[model samples]
Target: MQRIGSLPSDDSSPGWFHTSRLRQPRPPLIGDAQAPWVVIGGGFTGLAAARQLALNFPNDTVILVEAQQVGFGTSGRNAGFLIDVPHDIGAPDYIGDQANAKNILALNQRGQHILRDLVEQHNIVDAQLRHSGKYQAAIEDKGIAVLNAYRGGLEKLGEKVQLIEGDELKEHIGTSFYRKALFTPGTMLVQPSALVKGLADSLPENVKLYEDTPITAVDYGQKTTLHHPTGRIIADKLILANNAFGQYFGFLQGRMLPIFTYGSLTRPLTAAEQASIGGKDFWGVIPADPFGSTLRRTHDNRILVRNSFSFNPDGRHKPGYTDKVRQSHRLSFERRFPTLTNVEFEHTWGGGLAMTRNGQGFFGQLRENVYGALGCNGLGTVRGTATGTLLANMLAGKNESLTEFLLAAPKPNWNPPEPALSIGVNFTLRTGQARAGLEA
Candidate 1:
């Protein structure tokens, strides 16, 4: 039996979750329950796994457990891009080997297709799912060079891209802060909280979802048992889709890094304030530098600025961390929109991101009757869904190409112990952010 050590306990409320319409969360697990399949974590991966399992095994019972409401976790705290291409945050050019990049693109596209279908089928209008594409914008010369390299890589992959600059770029994004940008029309933007909530609410009837139920311990075997505060679950098979917290379950130790990224959103801009920035109603911009700030104009006329990374092994941030990060976000936002001086951030929050030394994620059987799909690097929105769906398909004995591809993917490399790991990670993050300069 493994005693879970830590769980996600963010100190701030995500702007995405705060602005979303509130709904009654599914009741917490109570007493005891038994199911053919049990999934831990109610984020993107667990939700996808539970839904797919139900679809694959209609007669079997699938149970999904969450420590909090579905949209209140990391899944709803992202910049809300359903990226359809390779977005390796560790890579200098956001592209690795050509062959591997192609495979990743296909997998991400598959995930996007799955989500698009669900949004249409369920009529989840609040999700704000749109194929708005996205821009990789650069402010400095160094950042511009990075964007040029990224554009070259995309063109090599036979993907369509457009270069927008000067007045034209300002007209589109309402920001003269960027010197140039590479626009790719494959990525989809969304209200991540709404999307995850919709997916959870529309889950198949065979899949039972319980909220605010944190697994306290686990006994792994042919028939695994998971214990919570007031309830226990016995299942023939168990899936751990909890990302970095998977280490607490006695797996992926010393292999995964729990990193936190922060974001801040302003209250909806007034009509006059919106006109001050002459641009489209909504658009998203990713910095050319991986460590730089990510900006978005929401459908309801608000600006979101996301940046800063921290090494937090406990899967939680310290008190006042969000306030510190929000200061940095304010600088980033002000630099881009100097005219919106009076605009203030209404919400600021942070989310955990699971990373690995080699940028590889764990996928496949971890032990007897137990499997895991986690460490999504920084692209959890799409990668998490893809790996989760593929994992369920693999368990169902579906011999599809994507499933095989995922099973063959490399796992995270081991990291040095303790102080050394922390020291190295902190140094890298600080230096990277410093180099991002005005981009941040």
Candidate 2:
């Protein structure tokens, strides 16, 4: 249908999450022709859509193919924080269609519930998932205003959120930097990579999954075809769930600019150390300041921290780490909890997130019935899940609510290094960092 930027078949993840976390049997590709439905990208959105389709429509043969193993993308490599609402700090403007935005939000909440039910029903213990509330802390007056405005809007808009300020905040999260904070109790945290692996393993036989089979080129038409090295996939419909690193699909790349964010996990703390920072009961996030971070404690007893942003000129991993922008984004951690100075991270990693020029998640037809979803911005976990399903449903001729609110196609590839993304990213990040400091 639409075109995506070029992406390499090889992935860039260090052996961090894979070695220690994700555990799913990588399925091999049988051949080019699969069922009428084929989904690309094995991340949460892709897998979710794949499983949902097979469960809802048992007769449809669904094939899901991934360039690498499961949970290999940002979906699995992400810091383990799950906020129920489908929202991005920049979403108000990014999602210009208000009706669509509302539907996106509702769908995200439903997805969260869907995940929770699946984890419980299947007893997905490897995910080590836990239900812990998350906080949107206020760093300054403007930040507080933003949180309050969001809280007010959510409350008026019928979003299930509770606003806590002043002393009430102390009872929830012990961060003093926040003058006020908004709380969402329905969120759950998980070992993201593990969760993805678990989901993939739970797929029904009707949903064929393949790894190590990368598509060399995507030939789209009434019946979309994906070309692989030894095989090809010809399906009645195709769905591209690649957010960042989605460049490989001729339809995704420059259409959605990929931006990177860094995250580090702290070694588990002793009882004394745990008390020093607040207890290990929750996760926290600041408003969306491009560099803004979201953090949480995992069921494995480690602190999973995510913050800061990065860009690779090559659009792949940079060689030997050319530059280090901020000394330590953990400063936000230290400022909020001084005791973290003594804490150390067992591992640190980062991943790219995709976004379009307009900031909306890209969805809709590429051609006759084929569809693509991209641009999760910062909240792709939920947004991707929402878009992945919406796109799948559209191909199936089921849901049209999201389609109705979808926006005009953004000027393709206007944002980046797909043709020249690195330069754009470096310039935009520097400017954004400066602006954030001034605003701070």
Candidate 3:
């Protein structure tokens, strides 16, 4: 089948995490290389997969290629919530079926443990890793109901969760705007770009990393040959870890929805502005309304706000998208913290996230001699790492229920083409935002 999508240009995101430190250049692939395994993409999933392969087979060569720098894509553009619960953004209620929810929770927990071990082992202090849990806050009565349902869902899975409201919610979040909130002690937070960069920098000796090397074409046969302008990678096996970009390779084409979410970060607050805010030094909050905003306060006193989604099937965003997003973000920030009106956002950017209509994603073989673990929905950090590590283990001949689930999870449902799909998704988003009301 002919490929129908173009490679995304380097993201124009001005992320705070990457800008905080100087970036060391990683050399791109040159000439040609032969390896037993080749993994595409340099995000969390790809990095984790490459790491697993190197760890499992020290004698075998593993090659990893990226179209851009390691964390420059969706991997680095996220708000960095390592959620350990089911967060099905497509569901009528954010939580899905009970059995699947429990299973997904288990998967998330497993992935969290793996990442935590890596963070500790590598001493990834620059990532600003935090074991701090997340707050699911609701502003309106509808939002409160949603939070209640979410808490009930967690209870059904025998998970511990604390539901707070009124003064309790205000005291915890330092905001009277939230009427109710659910605190789950499992979510972890980090500087997304830093974590991915640290992981790439600490890869095993058996793994070769090729940055800024976009594969222009792929010739799949008994062995897959990935062709880049500077070099080619010929490997006995191929693993797709590019998430939504995998659709371009005819891996779950027309199944996953390629949507872009927008985020904006404020410059670090001065001590006066920080005191005006009156909250803790750091906290992360995921909105109770799926369409509402996600907010985070950084350790350095900067605030990050994520809200807004647009359907971009080809992974290309319009030129004026960020301008519009910045206005929305400014409004969101002003509404939440009137005290810090002078604190303006320093950066605004968009990142692609693949959404499945049925809340399921592809995580198995897509073609002969080719394997994939794409579509993290919105929970890419934990789920992507889990799927990538599990993909490596699956290829290394490991089998368990989690392995089976990873290999056999349902693929994304088909979406209509072009303008029709775009219209439908935007309509759904608008309706959700309307329902979200003040929460948005």
Candidate 4:
């Protein structure tokens, strides 16, 4: 029933938007279920963990529960940038210590490799795998200095990054506003919904997935029970991959905040219009806007413009998602590329990224043996993928080096206690939007 809005179970995993690939039929549900481990959330991280568990430890039972269909949240709604290193949109949020930092880098690079491998191994038809790198473009005067400073972080990671200036910037992204830029080649782009469906299809047969089943309650301890309106899943162990929605679990809610982001694709440009913008090769661009606008080109020549606005663009929320936010990405895109304003908004959607106060992601065991991973902070393709792998390893048995480092605090510290939760998120969002409105 949810169409052209934020992803949610049964709500809007949607039949709309630029072609989201078809997915496998939802698995039959079981009442009072039981499994060795239950992953609550059918998005990327949950599925990734389930797939790995079935492959590596086939004997162990894994059950994935989603409120709606697979790839129902950020995983399905992402702009499909399977990126690698050097882009610090949200990496700093997950790496709290030296060990955490190294793990973050290693796993992200691993995610890049993993994404390609999945397409090949599974023969995912919808996977239009292309190795299109990402370009960072500067708009205002201060943007150049900000990018130069960012280059330092890229260098510290020892990952390869190419900076674009003058002619090259014009060559890649013709906008004159771009004074400086950065490029990383390993970033692959795909149709997010299709990629998600492909991943779901590849999930192990033994690992059951239930759609249209919203988890209403969590009963913790050795045999944690995940309760739904019509059924329940009782598992020996549990892994929380619910992201911003994990707050209902009580232990995870305030640790990280939920940041909302949106994206829109223009109706395919005609030959002349496409040429006017620049070459088709300049597909990906993200200007460091105060609210963060991301741009990309679709396979069929549509231009995808995106941005996220939280209750407070820079503040907090119960780590989760909402579909009701008023869309401003298309409006902002019109301002950035006025000539293209007439191009209709082919799609308008938003997703929430789990975020921490210090910009570090939270990982590790939530309770005794129950492991958890969330807080991609808008860089999920790489960060979420990597964290999923680490969580799997940690849950498997003895802690891997990466798992040991991240276990320091599996969730972010609680949210501020001043106003009510809902009130707080909206207050910040209203304030941020007010400021942006004034500046505009």
Runs in model 3 deviating more than 4 A are 1-4, 89-96
Report the C-alpha displacement of residue 157, candidate 4, in angstroms. Answer: 3.4
lDDT of 3 at 193: 87
- TM value for model 3: 0.96
Candidate 4 per-residue lDDT over residues 281-372, each given as its tens digit: 54687664345567777777777766656543322222334333324665666665677767887556666677666556667766765777
Question: Residue by residue across 233-337, what tens digits does model 1's lDDT show?
Answer: 999999999999999999999999999999999999999999989898889999988889999999989999999999998998777889899899999999999
Clashes of 4: 17
lDDT by residue for model 3 (1-440), tens: 24335786634765754565566748998899999999998988999999999998899999999888887888888998998988665455556677777779888988888888888999988788898899999888888878887777777778889987777666666566777789998899988888888888899999999888988888888998888877777989999998888887877878888888889999898988876657667789999888899999887778999998887777766678899989888988888888878888888999888888876778878888899888878888888898899889888898668888765666688888878877899999879877788887
By lDDT rank, best first, the candidates go 1, 3, 4, 2
Per-residue lDDT of candidate 2, residues 71-182 (tens digit) = 7667777766666654545544333345655776676776677677777887777777677766776665666666766665566456677777776665555555556667
Error of 3 at 146 (Å): 0.4
TM-score of 4: 0.84
Give the C-alpha lDDT of model 4. 0.66
Candidate lDDT scores, in order, read 0.91, 0.64, 0.83, 0.66
List the candidates ranked by TM-score, beginning with the highest. 1, 3, 4, 2
RMSD of 1: 1.1
